[model samples]
Target chain A: MNGVRTIFGREIASYFTSLFAYLIAAAVLLITGILFINNIGRSQDQVAPNPAAIPDFFAFALIFFAPLLTMRLLAEERREGTLELLLTSPTSDSSIVIGKFAGAWAYYTIILAITFVYQVILLNISQGQTDLAHALCAYIGIWLYGGACLAVGMVFSAATDNQIVAAFLASAALFLLWIGDRVGEVIPNINVARFIRELTLQSHYASSFAVGLLRAEDIVFFAGIIAVMLFITIRLVESNRWR
Target chain B: MIEVKDLSKRYGDRLAVNAISFKAQPGEIVGLLGPNGAGKTTTMRMLTGFMPPTSGSAAIGGFDVVEDSFEARSRVGYLPERVPLYPDMTTEGYVTFWAKLRGVRQPAQAARAVLERLHLDDRSKTLVRNLSKGMRQRLGLAQALVHNPPVIILDEPTIGIDPQQVIEVRETIAALRQSHTVLISTHILSEAEQICDRVIIINQGKIVAQGKPGDLRKKLNAANLESVFLQMVNKDKRA
Candidate 1:
C-alpha cells in the first residue's frame, strides 16, 4: 500500500505538471459546455429539465479522452526508461498498475465535477424541476464508466512502449466496446451477439444509468471491467522482467 | 553486501547472462567490465531484482533477491545504463519520489540530504529537463543513494557525461566505499582500474576473469587493464 501511495502521488504530480493533461481537460470542458447548451435548448421544448447532458456527451468524449489521458501513463515511462526505476524498486507490479488507474480516475473525476455547473444552471432555470436523483445516478455511472475506459486504456499502455501506438490501440478497443452491441443486427445468432454486447462499454451504461435507473448488474459490470483490465495490466507489466 | 551463485538469465532460446557468480563485500567496490552485448546490464538487472533470473540465486544484505524481493530490493540501489529522469519533475521531487518508493522515513529530508551530498541542492527546484548531462547522472546517483542502501549497482554511469563530471562522479562513488558495497559496470577499463578494488570481466555472457585490478594485470601479463580486457574477450570468443 505504501508503494501504491508513492506511485499514485508521483502520477498525480506528473498529471499536474504536464501540458498534455491540461489540454485534454480544457478540450473536454469546451466541447461539453457547447454540447450542454445545445442539449438544453433542444430539451426545453419537450421537458423542463435535462440532467443527462454531461454524462451523455461524456460517453462519446471519454472514448478519446480516456485513451489520450492514459496513453502516456505507462508507455511514456517505458520509452523514457523510467519503468526500470519502478520495476527495480521494492514496489510491486500490482501497486504500479493500481496507482496509474487511480491517478487517471482521479483526473476524470475532477473533469466530471467541473461539468456539474451545467446541472446547477439547469436546476436554477427550471426552478428545481431537475431530477437530482436521475442526474446523480448518471454521474455515478459515468464515473465508473470512465474508470472502466481508463483501465482498458492502461492495458494497452502497458502492452507497448510507443505512446502513439498505445493511444491508437486503446481507441480501437474502446470504439469496438462502445458499438459492439450493434453486432446483433448482422449476426443471426441472438445469444452470441448478446454476449458480445454484454462485453461492451455501452450496455452497462445505457440501460441502467442513462435512463435514471441504477441496476446492480451494470455497476458490477463496470467494476468487473476495471478489476479485470487492471489485472491484465499487472500481468503485462510483470512480463517485462521476463522479456 | 551482495552475493550471487550461478545467476543465469535466458531470453527464450538465447542465454543473455550465462551461469555466473561473484560477490561484493561491505566497503568494497567491484566493477563489471564487458563489451556492449556482453551481458553486464543483464547481470545487473537480475541483481537489482528488475528481472527474475532463469536459474540460480542472489542475495543482497542477507535477503534472497527472488524469494524475498522486497527485502532484497530495499537493500539495493541501482542506476541503469540510461539515466532515467522524468523531465517534468523538479530535482527535489524526483529524489523524494524515489525515497518514498524505497520506503525511507522522512523522505523530504532524505532527498535534501542526498541532493546536498551530490552538490545538487542549489538545483533542487530546477526542472530535470534543464539539467546538464552530468547533473542528470548525479541526480540519478542521488536517487540510488536516497534509500541509504548497503548495496549500490551502477551501470555505465559515466557513459555520456563530460570528462570533468565523470571525474566528480567517480570521486563521489569512491567516497561510497566507506560502508556501501558498490558494483559498477563501465567500458572504460581505466576508470574501473582507478576506482574499483576488483573487477569481473565478462564476455559472451560468461565470466572471463575476476580479481583485484592489480592482480588481474599481473596474471593476464597485459600492459594495462584495457589490454587485459581485450585479450580475455578475444580469447573467450575463440573458445
Candidate 2:
C-alpha cells in the first residue's frame, strides 16, 4: 500500500513536470469547450438537446486523449532507461502498475472536472430548470468509463518499452473497446456480437446512466472492466521481472 | 550472501545470459566486467529479481530470488546502468519516495541521512532532472542506500560523472565495504580494478575468469587488469 502511494506520487509529479500533460489538458478542454459552445448555439429544444451530452463528449474525447495521458507511464521509462531504477526497487510490480494507472486516472479526472464549467453555464442560462439528476448520472458514467480506459491504456504501457508503440497500442486498444459493439454487429454469430457489445465502453455507458437511470449492471460492468484490466497489467509487469 | 546456479536468459532466439553460476560472500565487492551485450546487466537483473532467469535459480541471503523476491529485494539495494529517476522531483522527494517504496520505516529520516552521506543534503530541494550527471548519479546512489540494505548491486555506478565525481563514488564504495556486500558492473576496466576486491570477467554469457584483481593479473602474466581482461575476452570469442 505504501509502495503504491510512492509510485503514484512520483508518476503524478512527473506528469505535471512535462509539457505532455499540459498539452493533453489543453486539447481536451479546448475541444470540449468548443463542442459545448456549438451545442448551446445550435440548441433548438431549450433544454440543450440532452443533459447527458456534456459528459458524453468527455467520454468520447477520452477515447483519444486518455491514452495520450497514460502512454508514457511505463513505456517512456523503459525508453529512457530508467525502468531499471524502478524495477530494481523492492516494491512489488502490482504497486508500480496500479500507482501509474491511478496517476493517469487522477489526471484524466481533473480534466473531466474542469469541463463542469459547461454545466454551470447551462444551469445559469436556464435558472435551475435543467435536469440535475440526469446530468449527474451522465457525469458518473463518464467517470467510470474514463477510469476503465485508463486501466486498459496502462496495460499497453507495460507491454512495450517504446513510447510510440505504447501510445499506438493503447489508442488502438481503447478504440476497439469504444467501438467494439459496432464492429461486432457485422459478425455472423449473435452470441459473440452480444459479448463484444456487452464488454464495450459504449455499450455499458451510453443508455441507462446517460439518461439519469443508474442501472446496477452498468456500474458493475465498468467496475469489473477496471479490475480485470488492472489485474492483467499487474501480471504483465510481474512477468517482466521473471523474464 | 548471493548465489546463482545455471542461470540463463533468452530474448527470442538469442541467448543473452547463458547457463552460468557464481557466488559472492558477505563483504566482497564483486566487479562484473563485460563488454556491451556480454550479459553483465542481464545477470545482475536476475540477481536483483528485476528479470527472471530462463532456467536457473538465484538466491540472495538464502532466499530463492523467484520464490521470496520481496524478502530478497528488501535486503538488497540496486543501482541500474543508466539510473532512472523522476526528473521533476526534488532530491529529498526522490529519495524519500524510494525509501517508502522499499518499505523503510522512517522514510524521511532514512532519506535525509543517505542524502547527507552522499553530499546531496544541500541540493535536496533541487529537481533531479536539473542536476548534473554526477549529481544525478549521486542521487541514484542515495536512493539505493536509503533503505540501508546489506547488499548493493550497482551497474556502472559512475558512467557519466566527471573525474572528481568518479573518485568520490569510488571512495564511497570503498567506505561501504565495512558493512555491505557489493556487486558492481562496469565496462571501464580501471574503475573495476580500483575498487573491486575481486573481479569476474564474463564473455559470451559465461564466466571466463574470477579471482582477486591481482591474482587474475598474475595468472594471466599481464601488465594490468585491462590486458588480462582483453586477453580472456578475445580468447572466449575465438573459442
Candidate 3:
C-alpha cells in the first residue's frame, strides 16, 4: 500500500508538471466548450434541449484526450530506462500498474470536472427546466466511461517504449470502440448485430446513462473493461522481469 | 554476502551468459571484468533480481534471487550503465521518490543524506535535465544508495563520465567496501586493478580467470594487469 501511494504521488506530480497534460486539457475544454455553445444555439430554436448533448460530447472527446493523458504513463519510463529502477525495487508489479493507472484517471477526472462550468451555465440558461437528476447521472456515466478509456490507453503504453506509438495504438483502439455500434448497424443478421452493438462503447452510453437512465449492466460493462485492461497492463509490466 | 551457481541466460537460441558460478564474501569488492557483449550486464541483472536466470540460481544475503525475489531485491541496490532518472524532477525530489519506494520511513531525511554523501547537496533543487553529466552520474549513485542496502551492484558506473568524475565515483565505490558487499562490472582493466580486491575475468559468456589482482599478475608473468587481461581474452579468442 505504501508503494502504491509513493508511485501514485510521483506520477500525479509528473503529470501536473508536464506540458503534455496541460495541452490536452486545454484542447478538450476548447472543443467541448464549442460543442456546448452549438448545442445551446440549436436548443433555443427548437423544443426542450437534449440533456445528453454535453455528456455525449465529453464522452466522444475522451477517445482522443484520454490517450493523450495516458500515453506517457509507462512508455516514458521505459524509454528513459527508469522502468529498470522501478522493477528492481522491492515493490510489486501490481502496485506499480495500479498506482500509475489511478494517477492518470485522477487527472482525467479533473479535466471532466472543469467541463462542469458549462453545466452550471446550462442550468442557469434552462431556468430550472433541466433535470438536475439527469445531469448528475450523465456526469457519473461519463466519469466511468473516461476511466475505461484511460485504462485501455495505459495497456498500450505498457506494450511499447515509444510514447508516440503508444498514443497512436491507443487512439486506434478507442476509435474502433467508438464506432463499433455504427459498424454493427450494417451487419445483415439481427442477432449478431445486436451482440456487436451491445459490445460497443457508444451503445452502453447512449441507451442507458447519456439520457439520465442508469442500468446495472452498463455500469458492469465499464467496470469490467477497466478491470480487464488493468490486468493486462500488469502482465505486460511483469514480462519485463523475464526478458 | 552473495552466492551463485551455474547461472545462465539464453536470449532466443543465443546464450548471452553461459553456465557460470562465483561468490562474493561480505565486505568484499569484486570486479566483473569483460569486453563488450561479454554478459556482464546480464549477470548483474540476474543478481539484482531485475531479470531471472534461465538455468541457475543466485542468492543475496542468503535469499534466492528468484524464489525470494522481494527480500533479495530489498537487500540489493543497483546502478545500471545508463543512469535512469526522471528528467523532470529535481535531484532531491528524484532521490526522495526512490527512498519512498524502498519503504524508507523518513524519505526526506534519507534523500538529503544520500545526496550529501554523493556531494550533490548543493544541487538538490536543480532539475535532473539541467544537471551536467558528472552530476547526473552522482545523482544516479545517490539513488542506488538511498535505500542503504547491504549489497550494491553497479554496471559500468564510469562508462561515459569525464576523468575527474570517474575518479570521484571510483573513490565512492572504494569507500562503500567498508560496510557493503560491492560487485562492479567494468571493461577497464586499470579500474579493476585499482579498486577491486579480487577480479573475475569473463569472455564469451564464461569466466576465464578469477583471483586477487596481484596474484593474477604474478602468475601470468605479465608487466601489468592490462597485459594479463589481454593475454587471457586473446587466449580465449584463439581457442
Candidate 4:
C-alpha cells in the first residue's frame, strides 16, 4: 500500500510537472469546449437540441484522448530504462500497474472535471430545463469508459518500449470498438450481432447513459473491461522477472 | 550475504549466463571482471531478482531470489549498466522514490543522507536531466544505497564517469566494504585489482578464473590481472 501511494504520488507529480500533460489538457479543453458552445449556440428556429451531445461526442473523441494520456506511462519508462528500477524494487508488480493506471485515471478525471464546466453552463443556461439525471448518467458512463480506454492503452504501453506504437495500437483497438455496432448491423445472424454489440464500448455507454438510462449490467461491462485490462497489464509487467 | 549455485540464463538458443557459480560472504567487495557481452549484466540481473535464472538458484541473506523474490529483493539494491533515472524528477525526489519503493522507514531523510554521503546534497534540488554524467553515476549509487540494503549489486558502476569521480565512487564502494556485501561488474581489470577483495574473470558467459588479485598475480606470475587473464585464456584456448 505504501508502494502504491509512493508510486501514485510520483506519477501524479510527474503529470503535473510535465508539459505533455498540459498539452493534452489544453487540447481536450479546446475540443470539448468548442463542442459545448456550438451545441448551445444553436439557433431558435431549429428543433430542440439534445444538450447531452457534448459529452457523447467527447466519448467518441476518447478513441484518441485516453491513449494519448497513457502512452508514455510505461513505454517511456521502458525505453528510458527506468522500468528496471521499478521491476527490481521491492514493490509488487501489481502495485506498480495499479498505481500507474490510477495516476492516468486521476489525470483523466481532472480533464473530465474541467469539461464539467460545460455541464455547469448547460445547467445554468437551462435554468432547470436540463435533465440533471441525464447529465449525471453520462458523467458516470464516460468516467468508467475513460478508465477502460486508459487501461487498454496501459497494456499496449507495457507490450513495447515505443510510445508511438503503444498509442497507435490503442487507437486502432478503440477505433474498432467504436465502430463495432455498425459492423454488427451488417452481420447476418442476430445472436452474433447481439454478442458483437455487447462487446463494443460505444454500445454500452452511448445507448444507456446518453439518454439517462443507468443499468447495472452496463456498469459491469465497463468495470469488467477495466479489470481485465488491468490484470493483463500486471501480468505483462511481472513477466520482466520470469519471461 | 550472497550465494549463487549453477546459475544459468538462456535467451532462446543462446546461453547468456552459463551455469556460473560464486559466493560473497558478509562485508566483501567482489568484482565480476569481464569484457562486454560476458554475461555480467545477466548474472547481476539474476542476483538482483530482476530476472530469474534459467536453470539454477541464487539467494540473498538466505532468501531465494526466485521463490522468495520479494524478500530477496528487499535485501539487495541494484544499479544496472544504464543508470535508471527519471529525467523529470529532482535528484532528491528520485532517490526518495526508490527508497519508498524499497520500503525504507524515512525515505526523504535516507535520500538526503545518501546524497550527502555521495557529496550530492547541494545538488539535490536539480532535475535529474540537468545532472552531469559523473553526477548521474553518483546519483545511481545514491539510489542503490538509500535503502541501505544488506547486498549491493552494481553493473559497471564507473563506466562513464570522470577519473576523479571514478576514484570517489571507488572509495565510496570500498567504504561500503565494512558493512555491505558488494558485487560490482567491471571490464577494467585495474579497477577490479584496486577495489575488489576477489576478482572473478569471466568471458563468453563462463568464469575463466577467480581469486584474490595477489594470489592470481603470483599464481600466474603476471604483473596484473590483465596479463593473468591473457595467460589463462591464451594458454587454455578457453571460450
lDDT of 2 by residue, B1-239 (tens): 88989999998998888888898888888899999889999998988888878899999999888899888888889988878777777899889987888888999999999999999999989988799999999988988899998889998998888999999999999888888999999999998998999999999888899999999999989999999999999998787
- Count backbone clashes in candidate 2: 2
DockQ of 1: 0.86
**Per-model C-alpha RMSD:** 1.4, 3.1, 1.4, 1.7
lDDT winner, 3 or 4: 3
Per-model CA lDDT versus the true structure: 0.91, 0.85, 0.91, 0.89
lDDT of 3 by residue, B38-153 (tens): 99999999998889999999999999999999999989989999999999999999999999999888999999999999999999999999999999989999998998999999
lDDT of 2: 0.85
Candidate 4: tens digits of C-alpha lDDT, residues A1-243: 887898889889999999988998898889877777777777245645465676687679899998998889889888888888888888888999999999999988888877877777777777767777788888888898889899999999999989999999999999888898676559988889888888998889878987889999999999999999999999988876665
Model 3 clash tally, residue pairs: 0
Q: Alpha carbon lDDT of residue A89, candidate 2?
A: 72
DockQ of each: 0.86, 0.59, 0.82, 0.76
TM-score of chain A of each: 0.96, 0.92, 0.96, 0.95
lDDT of model 3, residue B143:
90
Rank the models by TM-score, top first.
1, 3, 4, 2
lDDT of 2 by residue, A115-177 (tens): 877788888887887788888889989999999988888888889887778878888888888
> Of the candidates shown, which would achieve the greatest lDDT relative to the real structure?
1
Ranking by DockQ: 1, 3, 4, 2
lDDT of 1 by residue, B1-239 (tens): 78989989898888888999998899999999999989999999999999899999999998999999999999998899899999999999999999999999999999999999999999999999999999999999999999999999999989888889999999999999998999999999999999999999998789999999999999879899999999999887787
- Can you tell me which runs of candidate 3 are displaced by over 4 Å? A125-127
Instruction: Please give the range of 10 consecutive residues that has the lowest summed lDDT in model 4 chain B.
Output: B230-239
Alpha-carbon DockQ of candidate 3: 0.82
Clash pairs of candidate 4? none
